[model samples]
Target: MIYVTGERVQAYQVRSAFFDTRWRGLDPAQVHDYLCRVADEMDRLHRELTTARTESERVRQALRQWQSRHNGCRRRGHDD
Candidate 1:
């Protein structure tokens, strides 16, 4: 239910979004179907986010190792 400008939107929020019940309101079945689709998309986004985070961490670790190994390459006139 967090609807701030830049806040993260989770699947539950998408699935449980409140419908405007002041008048006839939305069709329940159609709303459920659409929410399910949107929730599925949110799940996919979360999976992609996890994958990106893992890959970013792996690349950062590799870069740290490379930097440690090549801390003084130019100063020693050695190119590898």
Candidate 2:
């Protein structure tokens, strides 16, 4: 019962979708292929997101350390 709203759609949502069959309905094989591709792309994007978040956290920590050091130096009257 996963509906694709305007917001973000997860891979599982895409996989769980089913189309009702009737006269002159859309091809099922094509739908399956497209869904597979979309799911694969979503998985790849998830991995990239995880990597980017980790990198961002590392950079944030590094910047905080640098700022702390700089502030300590200024408090000691050391200009650099």
Report the number of the highest-TM-score candidate.
2
Clashing pairs in 2: none
- Model 2 residue 54 CA deviation (Å) reads 0.7
In candidate 2, position 21 carries an lDDT of 84
- Taking all chains together, each candidate's TM-score versus the true structure is 0.80, 0.82
lDDT values for all models: 0.88, 0.88
lDDT of 2 by residue, 1-80 (tens): 65557878889878777888889988998998899899989999999999999999999999999998899888889997
Least well predicted 10-residue stretch by lDDT in candidate 1? 17-26
Q: Which 10 consecutive residues of model 2 have the lowest summed lDDT?
A: 1-10
User: In lDDT terms, how accurate is model 2?
Assistant: 0.88
Model 2 TM-score, 2 decimals: 0.82
How many clashes in each candidate? 0, 0
